[model samples]
Target: MENIAGTKSSLSWAVHISVAALVLIWLFPTVGLFVSSFRTADQIATSGWWKAAFPSEQNLTLRTDPPSTQVQKGGQWVIEGNLFGDKRGATISVYGTSSREISTYKAGETGKFRNGATITVQPNGDYVASSDTKWKGGRGPRVFVTAVTPPEFTLRNYQMVLFDPANREGMARAFFNTLTVTIPATVIPILVAAFAAYALAWMDFPGRALLVAAVVGLLVVPLQLALIPLLSLHNDIGIGKGYLGVWLAHTGFGLPLAIYLLRNYMVGLPRDIIENARVDGATEFQIFTKIILPLSFPALASFAIFQFLWTWNDLLVALVFLIDSTGETTVMTKQIVELLGTRGGNWEILATSAFVSIAVPLMVFFAMQKYLVRGLLAGSVK
Candidate 1:
């Protein structure tokens, strides 16, 4: 009775909970990356992305107006300015004149300098410094302040990561390079595998079973085992290490799964349709182009998503086959690795670059995801 058709299962609630938990587990870091990408370094350092919408306390080292801006006021030289400059709305809680005493004076109190100069800071970040003797030096003294700042977000991270002309490690070039590698790597295998899958699924040929077994066996072959030998072969053939080599490598590695997935899917398509098309004077080429390709879109799209993501995020293959001393052919994965080495402490930049790296794949996945489950499940039922 509990398993009656059209009745809900007793564990449906558990399934729902499990799925929701999985979604949240995957979603949390992605959402964190999206939020952190728009934040400043100081903000990122002080708090997590979950706290981004709330005011945060931060100890900041700032400089007053240069000594050149000092003026003779009454009998003393004076420098007056807002510590935040054009920025506003931060409330200083405590201030200090040196790094060792970062919270020595509460806001709105006057603290005396070594030379009898007095400086006063207000909670609103306004400050006035005065000294009896004329202030010497081209730069003003440093002021460290502990302030509660309102939530702040900026597009400067994205600008620096994607568009800054002077940024040598920017992701723009790597992004386009990844697209260059990914698109061709995805499309070429799909085109080749679609024909092979159609032939395997429908057209009778000698040694077909052995070829299918070989493809199945190839699926279990470790990609790393063949890299050096395949690379040597590429060099021997004059293809060398470049886009062509990497594209072929990705296509070769991707073809087995593509053929397996598409063959299973094409085999499940109505056989009567193909037989009728042949009986109605359609050639095998015509039957395939007109009948098989259109019906196999879901499987094609499913494999596209897989291959695109694999090729896009692939660092080892690109490192072995594509990257050179010029660095012009570098992809996002390699560029991100370089960033980890060079800018490990710059969390905002890392977050922005990581989010940018996943942006295209996310778009592609969401666009074609409906077909993914359908394609995977095509021959499983019948």
Candidate 2:
């Protein structure tokens, strides 16, 4: 009864719940990164991305007008100005004249300074400081305010991360460099593997079984073990440490899985189609080009997504093979690593850079994701 045809499973709701949880787990960080990328440094530092839509309270250290701006008025030296300067609409809840007691006085309350000077701050960040004698300091008094500010979002983080001319650590160059590495790395392997996979799946060869076994075995080989040897071989062949070397490395590493996936998919295609084409005077090449390639698109796209993501996010291979003293060949992963060292505290910049790096991969995945499960399940059924 439980296995009756077309009947619903008892645990279908559980499966749905599990899938929803997984989606949320993956979605939260990506959404957070997207939201954080548009936020200002102060906003990101003080609050989480989940709070981006609402007003936030922050303790800010601001300065009043300097003594130079003070004027003699009503037998006292007075300094009057807005703490936020041109920025408006923030309401200060509590104010303080010293760091130790940052929230000593509520907004609109007057407090006396050390030298008998009285300062009053309004909720709107306007302040008036008056001293009976003369103000002596070159600098203004430091006032700390706990203010509730409206949500702020900005494009300046993207400006600095991508388009700023003076930003030495900008991602524009690294972005193009990653694309240079990833596009060729992905395309070359698919091109080479498609041919090999077609031969293995459709064409009878003397060592076909051995070749398939070899590709399967190569899948288990650790990439780290081959890096130094492959690098040495590349150097010996005079293709050392550049785009060519990295491209070849990625292609070599990617081909086994590509061939395995594509071969499985190509093998499962209706044999009648290939037999009829062959019996009708079509060559193996003709059958492959016309019939097989079109049907194998899902598999090709699946491998493309995997290979594109791997090569795009690759850092160790780039570091080993794309050596450049001037950072001309640096990829986004390497650039982000450099940012961790140089601008570690700038969370907004880091968030913007991280989101920018993943943007293309996300687009690629979503664009071809329908094929992913279809391709992966190709030979498993038949």
Candidate 3:
């Protein structure tokens, strides 16, 4: 009884720990980015996102009156100014005479360092600093002050990414290009492979094992190995460097896996149902259209997810094939890479682009995830 109780407690502890860690791991960066996306460029550069969550202190520089600019009024050189110009409600905590370190006192207090050098900075961007000791000076002491900043966030980055014309050459065009490649590349393989899978799965033929083995073998052969040769083949066939060439390449590359997966799922289907359709005077095409197709929805949807995602995110093949005589045929992945080269410091652009690129995949996953898992498990159980 004690052992069982201990095990239950241990399991509960493990679950709690796992959930806490996962929540932190997922939320930490997302929260940081959420905070950072709203902050000013300077704020982002100077402090971490966590630091931005609380009020932050900033070191500021204020000009002091030179002896030349100072008027000898009441037997003392005096100057008046306020550091925060018309900006209200800034808390000034301390003042320093040098730029190296700004804080020398807290709010409503004076620094011993500034002793005999009374410097006053008001919230309304005016200041008056004077020295009690007689002034004979070339340069007055440089004044430093610390000010508090409040929380801030903005949707400017999204606006700049979506609506800005300058972004067109980048994500906007690449988005369209990705869709162009992804749609055709996805459609061609599914259409061709569906027929091929139906043939391989249901139709009787000689050398069927050998053909299936060849298709399966192609799966293990890395597509990278055939890059140059396939490019050469395209060139030889006069399909060089265009959307059609790219579409064909993706279809060819995506075909073997598609055919294999679909065949496995299709073949597992009850042979009796297929034979009954045949016995009822249906041709192979009619059987596939009526019976096989309905049963194969899960497999087809799963393959569609795979193809759409692969084609959408592909960089290398797109580089080799769709990369152009015209520079217009660039995809999202390629554009993101190029932006990293040119706009390295633009975090807003980088984050927004990344989010935009993944947005479709997220939608696709949510939409077809059920079928993907179901199709994958189809043949395994039976």
Task: Name the candidate that leads on TM-score.
Answer: 1
Ranking by TM-score: 1, 2, 3
- Deviating ranges (above 4 Å) for candidate 3: 1-9, 26-39, 50-52, 58-146, 167-169, 375-382
Candidate 2 lDDT by residue in tens digits, 191-249 = 99999999999899799999998988897788999888988999899997899999999
Q: What overall lDDT goes with each candidate model?
A: 0.91, 0.90, 0.76
Model 2 spans > 4 angstroms off: 1-22, 66-69, 114-116, 132-139, 378-382
Q: Which candidate ranks first by lDDT, i.e. highest?
A: 1
lDDT of 2 at 342: 89
Clashes of each: 0, 0, 9
lDDT of 3 at 236: 97
Candidate 1: stretches off by over 4 Å: 1-22, 378-382
Per-residue lDDT of model 1, residues 7-45, tens digit only: 686888998999999999999988998999999999999
Clashing pairs in 1: none
User: What does candidate 3's lDDT look like per residue over 1-382, in tens digits?
Assistant: 5476456664787888999999999889866765666666656766787897677777666555555766667866676644554545556666666566566555445443335667665543356666666656686566677777665567777677656887664477778888999999998898899899888888889988888889888877788987899889989999988899999999999998889888998989998998898899999889988888889888998888888888988999999988875678888888888888988887667767766787798788888888766656742323
Better of 2 and 3 by lDDT: 2
Candidates' RMSD to native: 2.6, 3.2, 6.3
lDDT order, best first, reads 1, 2, 3
Q: Model 3 TM-score?
A: 0.76
